[model samples]
Target: MEIEVVVPGGATIGEAPTWVAAEAALYWIDIKRPALYRLDPATGAQRSWPMPSDIGAFALTADPPGAVVALRTGLFRLDFASDKLDRLAPPPFDPKLFRFNEGACDINGRFWIGVMFDPLTEASPPLKSSMHSFTLAGGLRPEPDAAELHNGMAWSADNEIFYLSHSQRQAIFAYEFDPAAGRLGAPRLFASVPKDDGLPDGAAIDDLGGYWCALHGGGRLRRYKPSGAVDCDIALPVSQPTMCAFGGADLEDLYVTSASDQLMPEQRRREPLAGALLKLRPGVSGLARSYLVR
Candidate 1:
């Protein structure tokens, strides 16, 4: 399938891409640029907002005027209009060694976020990351099992299955999910990406039970069967397709985000579209995003 550039405005590290049905716009973050954007898909009208600190992840909240965001400092609620931030939770770990990364809202209206190792200089020591969940009533709490590079996150349509990926581990894990309570059981290895397939960064689940993942360094997107088999693979022009989400009117259009942060000068020159917002029709609709209940 062919993918066209949706919003040509280049991003440094385009990470989380999500659809807003009411606004008819796509929202995503450029981690390297350390900013947020709202793109009108049909009109190509783009609006960018700079963040006060390094923003790792964000999700549209149940409240129309705000969004829950994970920043290097901690979790905060941003008023999109006023650009004011209300600190909801402080960083659980020391900011010197860790920073927030991937995040998504669960079926129960809770936001699940993950953190990654961030060293000041080049270090060869083994590093690990952690995950957490947040709700206005419950506050922020940790998730079980520290990860090497916590990345992909998704829940099944039936709300009984959960998917998580650790980039350094090169494997995606599956767990029994309790949607009513937003809890996860013991996990088992569901599938592992081959060396040639690239590391998994972010992912989403379709209504048909297919898991769509962006291959960070391999420049591809893959749809995996619920049984842990590779069902479909689509190539992209960029070498580092970071994350993807299902958007558009019917949620059948797949939107992909890429990265140019790790690209060398030559690679950047070769792949001019490295950090672009891409779109395609995957022929399968996706489940609507779960709102973060205040």
Candidate 2:
């Protein structure tokens, strides 16, 4: 597989690459820069919307034809055409202590979001964080488990399993998912990275049940089988790859987002593609992304 640079500029913390099949465009966020970006690969035209606060994740919505965004302040609905934002719900915890991080929509159209302690602003951040499920009618519902830093959030093609990563722990976990009930069973260790390999950041599930995960400090993307075995690993040009998603017409193109935040000047120079958006043909098709039901 050959990797190519799609977007060349550096983003502070590029993450949550979501492909909109309807528009044949890609949407992603720069967390620290606190902006939402949309890119049209065909035309090479990109657009951005300034966010009021740090944005963790967002899911395309079908009903209102916009996006449901998870920002540090709370969950909000953003009108893509008008650039209007309407608050959906407030953050479950105090925003000062915790902020939303990773999220995605399930097959049922319920948005699942993860919260993490903000170490950048808080002098002494706590290790505890939580995940929540949101719907237009049901609102936000917190999960029973906790983690240090929640990153990867995805569901199996069958919707019978959910995958998440605890970056601080360098582990990715799998849980039996009750999609009908929107509940999670006890987590089982799905995969782990050695200290030198780097922390598992964000991930996506392919149609064949392969979990493609981005290794932050390791500068690689690893595909893990559903049985928790490694199948393939691809080296990346940037050291801090934040997330990956499957796009392109057939959902065969893998787009990886990287981060340059908090890197020393010399370190940034060494990793020239540190915050670039990269694309590669992974030779596998991905499942269609579920949109928010609201």
lDDT of 1 by residue, 207-260 (tens): 989999999999999999999899989989888998888988899899999988
Q: Write the per-residue lDDT of candidate 2 for residues 1-294, one digit (tens) a residue.
A: 689999985898999999988889999999888888899999889999889998988887775677888998999998888999999999887788778998888888888888778855646746686788888898888888787689888888888888989888888899999998888998899988788988899998899999999998889999999898999999988999989999999999999999998789999889888889999988899887775554
Worst 10 residues of 1 by lDDT: 118-127
- Model 2 has an lDDT value of 0.87
Best candidate, lDDT: 2
How good is model 2 by TM-score? Answer: 0.96
The deviation in Å at residue 175 for candidate 2 is 0.5
What is candidate 1's TM-score against the reference? 0.96
lDDT of 1: 0.85
